[model samples]
Target: SQKIEQNSEALNIQEGKTATLTCNYTNYSPAYLQWYRQDPGRGPVFLLLIRENEKEKRKERLKVTFDTTLKQSLFHITASQPADSATYLCALVSGLYGGATNKLIFGTGTLLAVQP
Candidate 1:
């Protein structure tokens, strides 16, 4: 019954602006959350990992917030440029039982388009 959803539309914006994206979920209590960036035809690169107890996390130009009560997470990219354009993925991780794998479940990503 666990599910994740990100914006399906491509976000088009001018360079040097901030890009904000949303991720919503239902029916799951995750221990951790992660954000990743993926280019076309390539695997995702980890950007940030936040625990359920953490309210906010930041790294360089990126920031993320988790709300376990609402089952949602938000991703933000400040001072974004054309080079920052890509698909962003939000993932949720839960503790697995014995002999099981602790894996991150990914949402369908949001494509960002930065215009110069």
Candidate 2:
């Protein structure tokens, strides 16, 4: 079966720095990859998405890179701040079973805490 993997531990960072998050998967090749940010007691907000043919994508201080060959995705936040701290999750379309409907399979997510 296909599986998505992410760092189970929380990440701590100082203000005005960069925070990098990793997401890995196995037994599948996804066409699209998405990243989302979730704050405590709230729903996740969409961050970015990268297609399999795209190498890198960015928006403001956020950047995402997808490597289909390696079956991995990296999420980055530059000039991080306290407000930017949240749990980040990576999701991909489960093309294996739900090819027609394209169900999204999300990773467990990694928590990020930025100190002021």
Candidate 3:
């Protein structure tokens, strides 16, 4: 069985510091890993995607590292701020598209609270 878990508690940090979050999983052979950001009731917005063969990926102030050996992923937000406060989700891309779109399985999420 495949399972994913993210820190459910809110992470409080200073505006200029880095915010790090963890994602753990068990029993899943996922094709690719993805990260998304969700604000309140809004749907998740894609952040970064890293294939199984890739060790790390980054965009702007965000960085993600995937360790298949550990079955875990880490997300980092540099220069955090109140505007960066939101819930971050880690997902596993599962199933073949059969030439169509792939399906993604998302974890609960970790709420980050960045202080100004």
Best model number under lDDT: 2
lDDT of 1: 0.91
TM-score, candidate 2, is: 0.94
Residue ranges of candidate 3 with Cα displaced over 4 Å: 97-101
TM-score winner, 2 or 3: 2
Worst 10 residues of 2 by lDDT: 94-103
34-77, model 2: which lDDT tens digit per residue? 99999999999999999999999999999999998889999999
C-alpha positional error of residue 101 in candidate 3 after TM-score superposition, expressed in Å: 4.3
Q: What is the C-alpha lDDT of each candidate?
A: 0.91, 0.93, 0.91
Off by over 4 Å in 1: 94-100
Clashing pairs in 3: none
Candidate number with the higher lDDT (1 or 3): 1
The predictions' CA RMSDs to the true structure, in order, are 1.5, 1.7, 1.4
lDDT tens per residue, model 3, 1-116: 67899988889999999999999999987767999999998999999998889998889999999999999999999988899999999999777646476778899999999988
